[model samples]
Target: MKYFMFLIFVLLFFDAKGQCCLHTDLSRKFDYKVIRLDHKDADGFARESKIIIELYKKSDKKLFQKIQFKTEGIGLSNVFSKCSDDRSYITGQNMKTEILDGDYGDIVIADFNFDGKEDFAIKYNIPADVGPEYCYFIQGDKGFKKDEYLSNQMLWFPWLINSKKHQLISIVSPNWGTRIYKFQYNVFSKKWRKIGNRFFRHDEGLDEELIRLKNI
Candidate 1:
């Protein structure tokens, strides 16, 4: 009888749900749900993925698919948000995803360039990206804006801004050949100006050279 009771206990334990606590804020106010993996048998923990829903309140859009990515180091942490719309995805594999830490840097929505309405000024890190360590401040009005300069040999740190304006986004890809590109409607000149620093790309080895990585 004791053995039978033990079997029942094990069954109940396996049937329990794994819950992860998360607090996410979006450019538009939202409610999110986070799901993790369940161990079929008692073992340890494998990397898990989280899904954040915008809770459209009245929209019919759901995450119809997922793509997988295998990175060299820590893998893609939850740090990478749905930076763009669903159609922004550029891959065809699905894998488990998650973030070990909840800090997603500065997500302030502001008029970073002092246009008029709120733009954005998210300060995040691509510490692993090959260039110099720098925090990315991506602003958003029509699109996004990233810091022009890049640093090297980064450090492990978290950034937070005191304002409640910026809505955080991703950093410019740190791969050697990348640049922060921005398009502007110059009121004074009445012309559309595409202005920014030069791009950086990997040539052979050691020394860093400049190259264009293309626009989104």
Candidate 2:
């Protein structure tokens, strides 16, 4: 009886449902589901080092698709650019897809373009002192396409998505205190532009400002 019960429990666990999460934002909200995966490429490497994702409708989980391209891995600095001499950074294919840490990142599903259909963003939590790398994909009738406008940007660290105003928020520190920049997204041009700016000390709460902007 003990063995039989264990078998039944295992079956129920596997049969319950696949792991997935949904986005609950306002401006670019959609009813889509996300399945995040941290995979290791079997290229004779000892460590598991890659990220894969699946997106599908919440109502119909069976119909889902995987991300087409391999991630360029978590960056140490600006892997896209070399600041010392302003030269481009080139790396081998294997290094590009390796995982930086156990927590690969998250898969966010929403309508980033104000369209009714949903879009997806892979926020790679790079194992650096700075923020993570971002990759956005716009959904179409057939499948998703990489948004070059967003991909080319050197946005690092964590960022917040404001659905009501369609803005992306980030805090920057110069020689003085910290400055908050509210970047609004332009769907037609597929770019981000600063709309609001504020300065605060290290002790001030930046999140409070983010919440306050939703009303304006």
Q: How far is candidate 1 from the true structure (C-alpha RMSD, Å)?
A: 14.8
| lDDT for model 2 | 0.47
- Residue pairs clashing, model 2: 27-163, 49-99, 131-157
What is the TM-score of each predicted model, taking all chains together? Answer: 0.26, 0.49
Q: In model 2, which runs have C-alpha deviations exceeding 4 angstroms?
A: 1-48, 55-64, 72-105, 125-127, 154-160, 171-179, 187-191, 194-208
* Model 2: per-residue Cα lDDT over 102-204, one tens digit each: 2123543445566656565665435343345567777787778877755555243224556676776655554445666566787677667667677887637
Candidate RMSDs in Å, in order, are 14.8, 13.0
Candidate 1 Cα misplacement greater than 4 A, ranges: 1-19, 22-29, 36-127, 130-179, 184-216
lDDT of each: 0.29, 0.47
Global CA lDDT computed for model 1: 0.29
How many residue pairs clash in all the candidates, one count each?
24, 3
